[model samples]
Each structure stands twice: as C-alpha cells, then as structure tokens.
Target: MIFMYMSHLECPKCGATYDPHKLTQLCACGSPLLVRYDLDKVKANFKKSDLIGA
Candidate 1:
C-alpha cells in the first residue's frame, strides 16, 4: 500500500514550506526542515490494527 500523507516540509525557524515529494536539504535560513502530513487523511485511511504485525 502506498501510504503517503506527507504534504510538505516546513522550516521551524523561518516557516518556509517545501515540496515533500522532492529531495530537499535545508531551509533558506539553514534550519532543518520538518515533515508536515495530512493527518486527517491519514486517520481516514489508516487503522490502529494495521500495525499489529508490522
């Protein structure tokens, strides 16, 4: 299953957003980028039982 709920990468300091599908290094301010996800979509598509084995 292709579970890709990641929407973008955000810089904690500069609040800059980057495309999550691309290879990104860091923000313009040299801050490490953090992943942002579509949590609502993930919750709708995923279940807690899905992790029972893996």
Candidate 2:
C-alpha cells in the first residue's frame, strides 16, 4: 500500500522530481525544493481530528 500518497518532490525551477521516501535537500539546480502531496487521498482519508495537539 502507498504511504499517505506522498506523491513526490519537485523543483519549481528545473522541474526535477524526486522520491519522497529518500533524504532530500536543495535541488541539483541549486534552487529550493517543494513538497507535493496527494490531496485527493488526504481529503478522503484524513480528518481534522487526525492532527496532533490541536
């Protein structure tokens, strides 16, 4: 089963993509990276109560 549908990591500048499970840092192109998530799965599977210390 996929883990939380954490789809992937992407660089907005160079459009480079990386696996979410591995250790990641600045993109190879020397730009900051961004996180992308599977919002569909999150909306369906997650709830406000799932938040911790809320």
Candidate 3:
C-alpha cells in the first residue's frame, strides 16, 4: 500500500477541516473546500519529475 500525504480538506472561509476520506464537496459555510497536505512528509521525496508519467 502507498502512503498518502494529504492531511485533510479545509474550508477557506470558515477555517473548518473535514476528513478527506469521506464524500464531500462544499463546506457547511457554503464555501468551496480546499485540500490540505502534509507537505513535510512529501517535501523531502517529491519533485516535479515525479508527475512526468502520472
């Protein structure tokens, strides 16, 4: 299994966070949700070249 770096989904307007595993679209505040990641986990191993074939 591959480990993912995504932390959670957050609402920009209300600053609310939701689980990324569940089905969701807009936040309760009626604002679009944003994806938040644990960049610290990927920063050391990720690079632009990783997306070349993906």
Candidate 4:
C-alpha cells in the first residue's frame, strides 16, 4: 500500500503542483519537481528505524 503521508509533487520555484502517483516531467517554469509529504502524519506512523535498511 502507498504511504498515507505521501501527498503530491510540487515545483519549489513556481509553486506548481502535480499528482504524486503519476509520472510528471518538469514544471512549466522549468524547475525540478519535488515530492511533498504530510510530515506530521508520516511522523505519527513511521519511525526513524524504519529507514535502517533502505
């Protein structure tokens, strides 16, 4: 299952947003996109140790 906190992709420079589950190219403003997450929700569900082997 997908993580509940994984929200969407966003362009940091232009503030453009895109669907996280889909493949997306660069934003129209020509900036690289980044994955956005709900940090509070993620923190509630995951532990730092979960990343040990990843």
Top lDDT hit? 1
lDDT of 1 at 20: 80
Highest-scoring model, TM-score: 1
Cα shift from native, residue 5, model 1 (Å): 0.7
**Candidate 4 residue runs with Cα over 4 Å from true position:** 1-4, 47-54
Per-residue C-alpha lDDT of model 1 across residues 3-46, encoded as one tens digit per residue? 38887899999899999878686998999999888898788666
Residue 6's lDDT in candidate 1: 84
lDDT of each: 0.82, 0.80, 0.80, 0.80
lDDT, candidate 4, 1-54, per-residue tens = 345677889999989999877867688899989888888777755665477646
Give the winner by lDDT: 1 or 4: 1
Model 4 scores a C-alpha lDDT of 0.80
Question: TM-score for all predictions?
Answer: 0.74, 0.67, 0.70, 0.63
Can you list the residue pairs that collide in candidate 3? none
How should the candidates be ordered by TM-score, best one leading? 1, 3, 2, 4
Flag the better candidate by TM-score, 2 or 3. 3
lDDT of 2 by residue, 1-54 (tens): 446778888999999998888858689999887888888887766665466435
